[model samples]
Target: MNFYLDVDRTIITKEHREALELNDFLKYLFNTGEVYWLTTHCRYEDTSSVLSYIMPFLTLENYDLIKNIFPTTWNTLKTEAINFSQPFYWFDDYLLEVEKRILLENRCLEKWIKIDLDKNGNNIMRAAKSHNPNLFSSI
Candidate 1:
């Protein structure tokens, strides 16, 4: 499945604090090949600046796979995504409402997922953890 993410104010940040679990979740998604794509609608300058800031933590492979980044406008990208399959996920604080609207309008995309800006509490990570043999407690 492909995971499409909005760049600015989502993954990259400078001020305040970010959740370590959420950060680890993202790194797992990219490193484990669980997500097929990551996208953004932000301007080039903002994307560039964020990428520079995040470069230290991301591996070279992740930097390469992120080539799927598309320069898309918010309204227009919806139409392009209409016919696509593969359990696509849209991750961004900016896209939550839009994703809901699109899901309502486009019946074909009902299977797609809209991930919140917060990425914890009973999600893919928990699902994966369920299968772990080393987990001692009832997690």
Candidate 2:
């Protein structure tokens, strides 16, 4: 499965301003499936902007792991970069209306995992604990 990640509230904590279990999450993602950047900070082939923005929140080991996440290119909607043919999951704090529509049309609206730290700070931890090899199938 393909795992797309966003850096903001999805991975970094809004209150603490630090990444919690970011290293472990990245390690799990890389080991289990294909990981990619699907955030505004990263577009096209260059991931320097996203890496620089997330650098302050990550440890040396976390930074190294993050660099391995593949870059994605999209013109308008982030969904454009998504490979609908394969099973995938998108982790983000927010989703645009157009993007939501795209996912809804494709019958994969449930694939978007909305991460709201304000609502529940332990959401990431819960997700980590619930990891499975056949992620989509199990769900």
Candidate 3:
């Protein structure tokens, strides 16, 4: 499955300002085979340049292994790239009109979890719970 997320508030965060339960869910995800991390963060080379800073919290061994990291504008260009039959989970602070447009074109079974801007953890999980039961056991 493809798991897209926002960098700042989703995965890595200071202990004092972060939610504890996310570790459990993240561990479960990594434990499962075939996981992909997508980010609409900084520009491709820009984000890759900070690999050292991003690796402590993530196991991105090299920048190239980080598939699907692209600009917000790329959302409009990905229509035919992804296999519509495969599952997808997108988490972003602020969803773009283009994101919604792409989601609308996807197969009916796929879900796009619209996460809150503040990283109120578990809302994404809860949203997945209601729609994609396959992820609930992991959550």
**Which candidate number has the best lDDT?**
2
Per residue, candidate 3 scores C-alpha lDDT tens digits across 1-139 of: 6555555554444332333345445544545434443454443335554344465555443223433343322343433334466665654444457656777866532456544424444333443344456665643
| Residue 65 local lDDT, model 2 | 86
- Give TM per candidate: 0.44, 0.85, 0.55
lDDT per residue for candidate 2 within 86-120, as digits (tens), equals 98888887899989999999999988877666665
List all candidate RMSDs to the true structure: 7.4, 3.0, 5.7
**How far out, in Å, is residue 51 in model 1?**
2.1
Report the alpha-carbon TM-score of model 2 versus the true structure.
0.85
Give Cα distance to truth, residue 25, candidate 1, Å: 1.5
Which parts of model 3 have CA positions greater than 4 angstroms off? Answer: 13-19, 42-47, 55-82, 108-110, 117-135
Q: Per-model C-alpha lDDT, please?
A: 0.44, 0.79, 0.47
How many clashing residue pairs appear in each of the predictions shown?
Answer: 0, 0, 0
